[model samples]
Target: MTQRIRELLDGAVADLEPGVSDPVAAVVRRGRAARRRSVLAAALVVALLGGGLAAGRQLVTTAREPAPAGPAELGRPPVPRVVGRTVVAGAMRLPIPDGWTAVENDPSRPCGDLHRTILLVVTGNRGCQNASVEVYGSERTYPGGTLVGDDLLDEDHRIVTPPVAMTLRGGEPAWMSESLEAADLAPDRYPEFAFWNVVTLPWSMVMLQLRDDGPAERKILDSIVTTPTEAGVLALPDSARSVSLTTPDAKGRNLPAGAARTKDQRTVAAVIALLRAQSDVVDDSAACADPGRPRAAVSLESATPTMVVITLGGGCQEAVSSAGGRVRLSDATLAQLKTLLGIGAR
Candidate 1:
């Protein structure tokens, strides 16, 4: 796993440790996405504090602006400084700070709902869209206590000032909390700010979430702002990167005869699509030579297995007869199957 992904998974594990009622309870009560959203909103509190950006706006446009020509690549003041290759999201280019760890996701792995998240531990108290800023592109809101895809703040268990604690990262004070529950909450109060930031890209969605607020957030933000874009060096380490399938090729690839379509195929197809969507990563060149051959191949890369090459060759009917007279794709495999079902020409 990439450093970023390891930390994220570790955070989730930490939240689940015994006696850690706050984070665990919050997660169980609210949910992973909700908790992540809430934490992100908290970190963003500072960034959104002064800026008079529109709130509750539903932005769904595609951002395709090319990287700036010179060193002043990161956005203007108050935004995270980034050096190296700027990540392109929906309508914006994200800056990657220096000295922070990053994790690249595997292209072969199935893409989750969150798509991808970039984690950084920076110094300073100032906040800059702490959540998934790289995925949703802009802040947004869903209906009925639902956290928007790009919402920096999480409202799964809505509260203005959720319970909080302090931690350390990059030699800075970081803050942690489960739900934002302040005593003086209004009936319909949404957090003033949190950590979720969504940036949309031409190929896939990117989400950035700040688990804590302390030296880490500041350090990360600072690096992003200072990193020079001229050299094409992304100062911030991309601990995790992911590529997905651009399309499916059912006509050329082979599948088991009598293979019944299942929901798994759809899920896997989505992940494949996401991986192939990356601008830097190229799609698999090999195509399914024969759709009726009961065989197919998929190419992918990520943190785990740098490249996952799956070759499917067996009629569903034949496999079923061999394995307890039944043939079914594992839940995980189903995800990939879904992608194949949807595959089109590259």
Candidate 2:
């Protein structure tokens, strides 16, 4: 197609009018898929014509804390700007770089949103790869529900590649999962999700993932672990105290498999609380429940269900007697735990 024709088609494709119930209706349920593809193809021609930045170059920032003004620039490429710096506690801060956005809807938890694509960039060592971290949400709503549409680029992550059906966004590879369960009990309707990562340059990159529910996003988002640095994370309220939990295993009369399942349940609960807490606010985390194994953990938002960092400890699984598995909380941590449990913070 001629460049002019392509541009025109591109505009039409981008305009796939989906209403509220199906905002993504344009690409998901409607017959506009082919047109959408053509538009994305045309737009890619324009992006290449302007500058050939690859898919992994797009970065995202999702810090609620205001970015430093006139702070020392790391002298990285100009494409990715300083989004925000989160101070989890003294001597530990993570940088939320540019091109990403934050999400804050849950009343209980409040971590900002960083586009998943941005995480892939840093994870794979594309840009500033020194153990970079990013957070994602299954409940998040981007321009297109699926990562395949050109509208996908409109998100904080900004899809930069040519439109391809079920293509990888950024540098991350693509994988899809169906019927994943969410960590939170909240009701969600999304059922299909896709994921992949892209390494941009030695200093930066882009990572992408889309899910029908928040569970997969939570699990994966909860898995990101970052190195402690002097940058500092977001501060919790004075009322906020570092809290921790180690839920006890309830498997009693079951066989070894049942006991193992019970142990997993306890671990999952502990991890969920940790993840939910991590998505909110509480500082300084370590696995106290099962020190022998890596407990699932993540950094929480200051006020909402925003996930800062996530990881599965105990190497993702471990075995233990019922009595041995108990979720423990520090006295100070217990104060914060009450709020999560709706028991009022001590």
Candidate 3:
């Protein structure tokens, strides 16, 4: 019985020691060692569980605590001085006074279209009182012999003075017309002189109209600085022979597969004229890289191919060119070009 018990104990603690010459004594020693190891393992497990519970409770407490408050954010800065500063209205940038505020017409309105008319109203107290200035321009060219003075005159309203020839600050010829009555207004209620100074340009016709304010309006008119015409506006390279429009392929290819030649001479001439009359060059260097494929492309066949790549649809930049030495087209110029190309306006 004693031998059998020793054998059993020796087998249970066999993992503690592999080799044992004295079976009984080896079993006794291994049994004591195994008991000690079990006690140590139990103590280690309890310690780990206790530490984990304590850490978990600390995390819960931290999460339940309220966050501290912070200071409020600062407000936006005040509007800058407008005196002697340039304010952009459609394609042209006009000078405005410090006290005057400019308001653009709604884009949905007929006069708000940049290609048709760009109307900007300048007011001193946000009302059409005795002192107010209105600036108007258009991208479309007027008919030949169109009189600016005749355009301002109306048979319904009172005429303060007849149309007279005037000279702008740069010696440019202008027509000055004055009226005692205002459009859609009563003369007795608003007894103000309506003054109109119309100037014609190759690209568009601009008019500066003031009501009952001569000196202030004249000062604003004198401060007007027209945008300079960029080079290569009218100069078409002699190397250029033909122009063509290319559309993208439906199979998601970058290659110009769908090519269509534009043989309409009148359309081509209109496009050229519009390009020649571009008054402003907008900086589009920071424009986002369009991920979508181009819609249409205008290629000018020359010794060195001068191309104007266009990408229509939403969230796309206007005409862009991969060819070097191509001028960047402004919004108005791009719209005119697109219209001439039968693409219509955006």
Q: In candidate 3, which residue pairs get closer than 3 Å at backbone N, Cα or C atoms, i.e. clash?
A: none
lDDT of each: 0.26, 0.25, 0.32
Deviation (Å) of 268 in candidate 3: 25
| Candidates sorted by lDDT, best first | 3, 1, 2
Name the regions of candidate 1 deviating beyond 4 angstroms. Answer: 1-107, 110-136, 139-207, 222-346
Worst 10 residues of 1 by lDDT: 317-326
Q: Each candidate's TM vs. the true structure?
A: 0.21, 0.21, 0.25
CA lDDT for candidate 3: 0.32
Query: How many clashes (backbone atoms < 3 Å, residues ≥3 apart in a chain or on different chains) does model 1 have?
Result: 107
Question: What would the per-residue lDDT of candidate 2 be over residues 1-346, giving only the tens digit for each residue?
Answer: 2343334335433433321111110112111232345556434433532332222222333343332321112222212223354312111122333543333222233333333323322111233321223322111111121223224334322221111111111211111211123122123442222222211111111123332244434344333333321122222221111222222213311111111111122222332333223222212242222112222112111122211111123322211110011122233343232233323221
Residue lDDT tens for model 3, 153-246: 3211211121222223332223333211223123333334432323322121333445433444455556655332221323333223444544
**Candidate 2, residue 160: how far the Cα is off, in Å:** 27
Question: Which candidate tops lDDT?
Answer: 3
Among all windows of 10 consecutive residues in model 2, the one with the lowest summed lDDT is: 22-31
The runs of at least 3 residues in candidate 2 whose Cα sits more than 4 Å from the true structure, single-residue gaps closed, are: 1-234, 237-346
**TM-score for model 2?**
0.21
The true-versus-predicted C-alpha distance at residue 306 of model 2, in Å, is 4.7
